[model samples]
Target: MASCIFCKIVKGEIPSFKLFESDKTLAFLDVQPLSRGHALVIPKHHGEKLTDIPDEYLTELLPVAKKLAIATGAVEYNILQNNGKGAHQEIGHVHVHMIPKPRPEQGLGIRWPTQPTEMDKLKELHEELAAKMQE
Candidate 1:
């Protein structure tokens, strides 16, 4: 993770507008923000994806996100976590985007695209997932 920008930020090699820090994680303002109080929350340990983070670290990570949300006075907001290239993950480190909604200029104006799926296929897929969860 020597070249990872987030790791550099965590290590103080790169400057960030840091907001909050716990033993396990750090929260900071994004240089390029979606909204006024837009922030990124990241684990101190480098993890490229969600599952790579230890559960103990994750437990501390989320409450910090909530703290940022409240500290920013985000009356409505979204918490975005992305993984893998296909999921639009620009940075290889696992981080959460806390974007306050109703920004002065409509915020980031992000949208979730949807596609239709057959109900029978959905039911079968759900059943398959439920079976997998037990394993």
Candidate 2:
């Protein structure tokens, strides 16, 4: 984590427009923002992805993001977290983006492609996942 930008920010080696900080989490304004109040919330513990971080480190992430959303006065927003390069995660640390959508043309724009569902296949997949969850 010596080269991780978020870790640098957490350690105060890199300067950031920090908004909130606690024992386990840090929230800051995104240097390159998509909207007026775009911010990033990160856990103090270094982790490249959600599964890599301990559950206790992750507990404050969403609560802080929620606080950022309220502080931004954004009624409509998107809370986003990406895991890897293929998922567009530029940083090698887990971070959540709180993007405020004040208008139709702003914030995170996504195209969710919908596919027609095959009920039997869907049911079988659901059961498979449910069985795994029990383990």
Candidate 3:
């Protein structure tokens, strides 16, 4: 973790364009930004991936991300968290990329294969997931 750039940022050993910080997380402007307001949200504690974060800390991450997006004047935003090498996770630290989507021509453009799901299939999938939820 000593070599991890995000950890260094959290520790203040390295400088970042810090936007927000709480007991559990820190938000800063991304050095290699996808857009003008692109920011990275990271847990104060070092974690290798999303699942590595404790549940308590994880709960605070998104609301902070939302607040940051609004503070940065992001008309819309994408919260991205890559988990492993196959998922294009370049950094070892668990950080969320909050990319401001101002216009179609701006920010990271993502391409994905689109498939249509039948209404019945969508309903079934929703029901199945809902049933599995503890709450």
TM-score of each: 0.90, 0.97, 0.82
Worst 10 residues of 2 by lDDT: 102-111
Cα RMSD of all models vs. native, in order, equals 1.6, 0.8, 2.6
Which candidate leads the pack in TM-score?
2
Itemize residue pairs with steric clashes in candidate 2. Answer: none
lDDT, candidate 3, at 16? 91
lDDT of 3 by residue, 4-113 (tens): 99888888899999888888889899988888888888888888888888887787778888988888888787999899889889999888888998889878788898
Taken over the whole model, the C-alpha lDDT of each candidate is 0.88, 0.97, 0.87
lDDT for position 35 in model 1: 82
TM-score, candidate 3, is: 0.82
The regions of model 2 sitting more than 4 angstroms off are none
**Number of the candidate with higher TM-score, 1 or 2:** 2
Superposing every Cα of model 2 onto the true structure, what RMSD results? Answer: 0.8
Flag regions of model 1 displaced more than 4 Å: none
- Candidate 2 residue 81 Cα shift, in angstroms, is 0.6
Clashes of 2: 0
